[model samples]
Target: MASASSSIIPPPQPPRSSSYSYHVFLSFRGPDTGNRFTNHLYSALDRKGIRTYKDDKKLRIGDVISDELEKAIEESMFAIIVFSPDFATSSWCLDEVCKIIECKNKLGLQMVEVFYGVEPCDVRHQIGTFREAFQKHERKGFHESEKIQRWRDALKQVTAHSGWTSKNHPNL
Candidate 1:
């Protein structure tokens, strides 16, 4: 029998770079928290002279994270994923999250998560809106089951890390 590795295709790698261009990569649901939380966070990071990559204005509307975005994520020193109520609904966001997790594992990239108006447990366990979002993905049946599972794994893995949540902090 043929070896399983022989038929399996490897994931694409980002272009080799000696140095990164940005200090941080911000991952968030644009319409959900773009105008308020993410905008403020980006401004704050920028004011501190922390170079950050934000995709809201950079990428044209596309089905998946473009190569430029993949490179941006790879080039950043750290990643901040803002898990809003609607985050999981977007496939691109899920793909980005999966890429972030891959970087964390393969490249030692650091990551921080912000639960914006959502509970950490919800994200960790795929409950509430997270569950609803996945249900939608399943119902649509457009993505391969394997791909959807990867998104779930990424969500669970990221939530396991220590991060911020807006549950008790109304001021934030």
Candidate 2:
């Protein structure tokens, strides 16, 4: 968490488009990286005068989840998904990914994937802990099959992009 630039190649700067309210939208598993890496990332963006939306409760499950989040994703110029060991464990995170990707397709929103402590291929294939997480999601039936499938497809799509990995950039 030295600064995102110190850890890996810095993502592109925000465009001067008037439609975007923020330069970046950060998505991560709170318990896995909230107090540590993400905070430093936020600070880095701030120091560079980049408007970043870092919602702590965005990954939280509750009545608080709403369309305002969808709006945030749409308005942001770019998104950064920090994939950690427990990232796929939360349904909320997957839901967010769906929205992030939807905007990526519809609004030309760009994305940066950071495989924080997990393998990119594992996420792409849903293996290891990702496999375990999906199994639990299916067993619990907390969401419909189509919804779960969308999450899987989203993971596949996200991982296909060229991304930064902790395996390659250990300082991240």
Who wins the TM-score comparison?
2
Residue pairs in steric clash, candidate 2? none
Candidate 2 lDDT over residue span 16-60, tens digit each: 366677778888898998887788888777787878888863435
Error of 2 at 32 (Å): 0.4
lDDT, candidate 1, at 120: 90
Candidate 1 accuracy as lDDT? 0.81
| Model 1 lDDT per residue over 1-172, tens place | 0222112212324534557887788899999999988888887777657688898756677636568778989888788899999999998899999999999898877788888999999998989999999999999984688998999999999988877777766876
Which regions of candidate 1 deviate over 4 angstroms?
1-18, 60-65
How large is the C-alpha RMSD of every model relative to the true structure?
A: 11.3, 3.1
lDDT of 2: 0.82
What local distance difference test score does each model get? 0.81, 0.82
Error in Å for residue 168 of model 2: 2.2
lDDT of 2 at 57: 35
Candidate 1 Cα deviation (angstroms), residue 52: 0.6
